[model samples]
Target: MPGWEDRARIGWGPGAAPTTTVQVEACPAASAPAAWSVYTGGTWVASPACVPLVIRSEGQQVEVRLAIGAACGENN
Candidate 1:
């Protein structure tokens, strides 16, 4: 079995710092390989790779979830 990496880019609009959540799901057949990424507020906040949940055969599904904290307040 081989390993690979993938990249994803996201963007945000002008406004106060806001919290966001991202979820990625991959379903592949025939012993395939895949990866995922999550971005928030135009920044690459988190990326986890080689999740064990990946199924190499059939009816395999991979799900990635992210919960972002609100940006620090100006008073901080």
Candidate 2:
């Protein structure tokens, strides 16, 4: 199974643009996935399975959300 690093916090707000770099471990297990995505503004952005995401501008401060599940068409 692939292991993921701890989540890194990045402050975001007006005039505050931060970019973070994350490393994704490689795993070749049936239960291990290799890709994920981040959601913002009702849209999904493809991202590394184990990487810190960059946030620019805190819009509405709604909340930072992440969804970890099977890829497009992989049965759980």
TM-score: which candidate is best?
1
Task: Report the lDDT tens digits of candidate 1 across residue range 27-48.
Answer: 4554666644333354333453
What does the lDDT read for residue 25 in candidate 1?
A: 44
Report the C-alpha displacement of residue 49, candidate 2, in angstroms.
3.0
Worst 10 residues of 1 by lDDT: 1-10
C-alpha TM-scores of all predictions:
0.18, 0.17
Model 2 lDDT tens row, 1-76: 1122233223233433332332323345668776554322221234423232333443532323334331432222
Cα shift from native, residue 47, model 2 (Å): 6.9
For each candidate in turn, give its C-alpha RMSD to the true structure in angstroms.
15.0, 17.4
* lDDT of every predicted structure (CA atoms): 0.35, 0.33
Clashes of each: 0, 0
29 Cα displacement, candidate 1 (Å): 4.9
Residue pairs with colliding backbones in model 2 are: none
